[model samples]
Target chain A: MKKVIVHVTLKEGVLDPQGQTIETSLHSLGFTEVEEVRTGKTIELLLDNHDNVEARVQDMCTKLLANPVIEDYRVNVEEAVQS
Target chain B: MKKVIVHVTLKEGVLDPQGQTIETSLHSLGFTEVEEVRTGKTIELLLDNHDNVEARVQDMCTKLLANPVIEDYRVNVEEAVQS
Candidate 1:
C-alpha cells in the first residue's frame, strides 16, 4: 500500500479572510510576530497499487480536493510501510 | 519573517466521515485504488519573529488549531524568505 499526501494551499494574490482573522487574533493576544496567515487543507489516503501514484493523486486534487481557480496543490506519495 | 505550518490530523481510531465520503466518491468514480482517506487542516502563518517559533506554533495548535482530544498536530516553521 502507499500513502498519498495532498497539500492544498491558496494561490498567490488570493484573499484569505480566515488567515487575516488569525493574524488579528494573534496580534491581539500579544503575538505581534506575525505578518500574515493562510489556511489550507491536507488530504491523506492509503491506497493499493496504482499505475502512477503521483498522477492519479494529482487528478484527484484537480477533480475534487482543491479549487484550481484559487488554490494550488502538491502531492506526495510514500510507501505505507506497514510493519 | 517565518512561515509556520501546522498540520492537524485526526487521532487513530477517530472516525473521519468526510474522508470516508471522499473515498467512496473516488471509488465510485472508477478510481478504486484508494482504501482509506483522512482529511486534515493545514494552517500557514507568516510571522515576524517569535523567540522560539516551533514552540509558539505548537502552542497555537493546542490552543486553537487542533483538538487534543481527537486530533494530533505537527508544526513546521521556516524562514519567510521575502525576496
Candidate 2:
C-alpha cells in the first residue's frame, strides 16, 4: 500500500476564521508568540496501486476533501516501503 | 515571500486518539461513512528570502508546529512568484 497525503488550506488571499480561533485558543493557553496561524486539513489514504495516483487523489480532493470556494489542495504520493 | 507548509499527522504505527475523536464528531454531525477521520495541522509562513528555507521551517515544525511524541511532519517550500 502507498500513502496518498492531501493538504487542504485557505487560498493565499482568503481569510481564515478557523485559524483565527486556533490562534486565540493557543494564546489563551499561553502560546503568545505564535504570531500568525492558519488552519488546514491533512488526509492520508493507503491505496494498493500507484497508477494514476495523483489524478485519482486530486479528484478525491476536489470532490470531497476541500471546499473549492475558499480552499486549495496539494497532493503527495509516497510508497509504503516497509510492513 | 516563500510559503513554508508543514504537515503534521500521527505516525503510521501509533494510535490516533485525536483522529478517533474527530471521526466520532463527524458521525455526530450526521456524516457516517466518513470512517477514518485523522486530523493534522498545516501552517503557512511568508518569508522574503529563500536561503535555508527548508532548515528554518523544519525548526519551526519541531519547535512548535507539531507534537513529536505522536506526530510526524513534512515541509514544502514554495516561492511566492508574484504579487
> Candidate 1: misplaced stretches above 4 Å?
none
Q: Note the residue pairs that clash in candidate 2.
A: none
lDDT of 2 by residue, B1-83 (tens): 55557777787778877667655654565444344546677766555554676876676667667789878999887766443
The root-mean-square deviation over C-alpha atoms between each candidate and the true structure, in angstroms, is 1.8, 5.9
Stretches of candidate 2 exceeding 4 Å from the true structure: A21-35, A80-83, B1-3, B17-39, B47-64, B73-83
The lowest-lDDT stretch of 10 consecutive residues in candidate 2 chain B is B29-38
Q: Evaluated with lDDT, which candidate comes out highest?
A: 1
Alpha-carbon lDDT of model 2? 0.67
Best by DockQ: 1
TM-score attained by model 2: 0.57
Docking class of 1: high
List model 1 lDDT by residue over B1-83, tens digit each.
77778888999999999999999999887788888999998888887766888887777777677899999988887766672
lDDT of each: 0.85, 0.67
Q: Per-residue lDDT tens digits of candidate 2, residues A1-83?
A: 56767777888879888667756765675544445667788876555555676876676667666789988888887766342
